[model samples]
Target chain A: MNNDILATLSITDATRKLATKEISSLDLVRACRANIERRNATLNAYLEVFDDVEAQAIAADTRRAMGEKQKLLGIPLAVKDNILIEGRRASSASKILEDYIAPYDATAIKKLKDAGAVFLGRTNMDEFAMGGSTENSAYGPTKNPHDESRVPGGSSGGSAAALASGMALGALGSDTGGSVREPASFCGVVGLKPTYGAISRSGLMAMGSSLDQIGPLTRTVADAKLLFEAMRGQDPLDSTSLDPSFYKEGLQRKKIGVPRHLLARGVDADVLKLFEETLKRLQEKGYALVDIELPSAGLALAIYYILMPAEASTNLARFDGVRYGLSRRGESLFDDYACTRGEGFGPEVRRRIMLGTYVLSAGYYDAYYGKATQARRTLSRECAAALKEVDVIMTPTTPSPAFLIGEKSDPLSMYLTDIFTVTANLTGNPALAVPMGEVKRTKINLPASIQLTAAHGGEATLFSIGREIEAV
Target chain B: MYYDAMVSKEEVRALAQLARLRVSDSEIEGLQKDISNILEYVGQVGSIVPNKGETQVLRAQNVMREDILYGPATGLINKGKELLTAFPKREGDYAVVRKIIHKDE
Candidate 1:
């Protein structure tokens, strides 16, 4: 089979071939590398394509010969810069940790290693996963694979781009806010952010401690389930990790709730048209679509921005000059810290840290952080109320298709893009982004996606619905 | 009660100091403007009346695990030397730090 065909094959297809000994892990790795060699330079998807990948594949082949048959045994995967894979450099796309090598594997990475999956390299991301675009990466921005001029929606932009461009069969990305799903929507792939605590976050760089989740960016919903299941489970290291029985799997209700009020103003007409068509398709298939109201839904982005940055500010305080990575000294201890952090973190990161500090400070805590937390509880309850009526809630993953690399110059406008996706993070509900169809922009058919959010512990529902959407 | 929706230059500097960051003069204006705009947008959360003194019950519970000295936390994941290797200024296994406490001259 052609290398292009081999590289482009989905995990489901690749695993079957690997199981039957029809394809070697070397073939899969080399096939992925061939495309990476061709496109990575321009796409800037991978920060580094590990030189030892071929050796890893050879070892996997040896294991297969011994009657070991793990589905991910030889599957090559792209890991986001934030996930630690022991001994490998995990930068979180920040200059401060650029030279820092991981001391231990993230729980997710360990699980994948147990499954015998091969790591391609750490893909680029927004520094500290702060921005919605990979442009915030200290190294550089990751362009959308579809159109070079547009950005792959970000934070997990590189992982999404890698999967879309056939650089990897599957990829892992961490989502806080819309990091995973937004990019997945932009790149026309499948991304899942499981219910909070569903996946252990040990060894993943801390961003918004409360909001951060390691997710899979893949070509198909089935591929995501395979990766998610492999990575999900309780970990003693990450106390928040949930047990398998924590979230019960319920029968598909075939009901999707649409919060029309939130979508009425901001969503692009063409994007809404595709969303409506997807709803109509599901309705024709005997799924019921009910209009639901989440009164606090509109405030989700506001609450998320407040809460995430507040958590990030504290999480980032550990990056003082003494411990690791880039450390700079100054006249006094205070000067040492201020100078090191000032020079270390990117502008967006600094901006967020400052925002977080302001919110958590004495006078403003009640007005900002305090109110946001209260509102977050309200939002969660509202989502729960809505979920009680319907199995899942639906929305356009992003307001529009992928935008030009530098299109959103203003920070507020860039944040407005996340309006539709932050609700799930706030509510602790599992959400999936699957490409619905394409919407044309400037003579290019950029992909638009539909986001389905299921109740807490409702990942199975999202996957089943996601597969149904994939069929559309 | 600062409701003007504008973070002043002095306020930005104070916040930067509190956060242990230094904002250059040129960047401060832009950063402050951006911060204020975000504050104004997110400030709407204040308007949400929380059920007239209803208690906010967070679903998060304390996750306690047995403190196994050689468990995954310390044994499986933690490698002392590998962690020390990341330190920029280390003396053997100890991370080197400046003397923050200075005796009166």
Candidate 2:
């Protein structure tokens, strides 16, 4: 097989070819490695290309030779640095844990391993998955494959970049407030954030416990569905992991909802045009598009910032430089922790930790965190109510196409990129970002995406609708 | 539509201390402005009227399993050494840390 052709084949196509013995797993891994060798230096996608990739592929070939049949068999996959793959470094792209090796496989990784997936390497990400762009990664940002100067949307930016650049066939990225979907949008790939608790989070680093979920970034909606199906299951390790029956799947009504008020402002003109075009295509495909109201969604980002920081601050307290990761010595134990954390975490991570402390602190908790919690419930209710009328809610994944590497300097502007995507995370609803079309920027057409958010346990609806959108 | 709430530099310092993070003097001003702006933006949640007698929604439930040595039974043991190997400061299967208790106190 032509290496270029093999590198670009989607997981579904590649699996079929593998089954027919038309292409060997070694051929796929080598093709991916060739692409990585050519582009990874400039792309900075995979933080480390595992030295054992060939061995893993050889094992997969042996498995197939033994007549084992698995859908993900012999697939090369890039995993975000936050997910543990057992004995591999899972630094979460932070200096504090730069050399920290995961002692156990994340539940999702275990499932993929069982399916015969070959581990390419851990991909780069925003340190602690805090930034909207991968710019906050301690190692450095992953660039967009479409445009070298532009950023791959993040904090799952590396995973998205790897897939878009053909460095990997599929990738696993953890989504906490658009980490997966936003990058998927910016990179012109399919990114899914399964409903909270739908996928187990056992081996994934915790960012915002309530909001974080591990999902797949793939070239096609069917590939995303296959990966999601393979990974979604209850795990004894994660208390929040839910069984398939935890929430009943919603009935498909062949309808899509649009909250026009939210999109009336902030969204880029070109992105809005593409989103309208996507909706029109869907409409022409025998689906009804209805204007739905999610009034409380205006507060979704605010609630997310408040809740995510608060939870992150609590979660990150574990990195005290004692048990594992980077350690530093100071005059006193307090100094040790202060200096260690102060120097260990990046600016973004420190800012978030302090913000979390401020919100959860006395005299301010009720004003910020408490109210945010109340407003979150309101937003969840609005989403649930809105879904009662429509099969899924749709919006532009990010306000614009991939922004230039350093475009969003101000923190607030950067946070606004997640305006539409954070609502899904806040409500624990499953959301997918599929490439709607591209918007021109500086002589190059950059990808922008339309996000479809479904009701709880409504992934099937998203897959069907997403596939239609992909077809269009 | 600007929110009046502003996080002061002193407050940022105090919060940083509480969070066990040390922010240099140079970074304090930036944190003050960024944190205040973020707080003001998120404070919009305060306008939401609470429902009558509504309780906080708690999705977590007690998930209990029988307390038994399941890892070894499932052939998942041998992780003890791996876990121990991660300790920054260790002494023969125990992580070493500074003593907090002083008898003289």
TM-score of each: 0.98, 0.97
Worst 10 residues of 2 chain A by lDDT: A243-252
Poorest lDDT segment (10 consecutive residues) of candidate 1 chain A:
A246-255
CA lDDT of each prediction against the hidden true structure: 0.90, 0.91
**Candidate achieving the largest TM-score:** 1
Per residue, candidate 1 scores C-alpha lDDT tens digits across A141-169 of 99999999999999999999999999999
Candidate 2 on A1-472: residue-level lDDT in tens? Answer: 7989999899999999999999999999999999999999999999999999999999999999999998899999999999998889989999999889888888899899888899999999999999988999999889999999999999999999999998999999999999999999999999999999999988889999999999999999999999999999987777788887865554468889999999889889999999899899889989998999988899999899999999999999999988899888788889889989999999999989988888888888888888888888888889999999999999999998999999988898899999999999989999999999888999998998989999888898899888899999
What part of the reference interface contacts, as a 0 to 1 fraction, does candidate 1 reproduce? Answer: 0.78
Residue pairs whose backbone atoms clash in candidate 1: none
Q: Could you give candidate 1's per-residue lDDT for residues B1-105 as a string of tens digits? A: 336669999999999999999779999999989999999999888788887755544557787656666455432444778878888998888989988787999
Off by over 4 Å in 1: B56-59, B70-78
Clashes of each: 0, 0
**Candidate 2, overall lDDT?**
0.91
Deviation in Å, model 2, residue B103 alpha carbon: 3.5
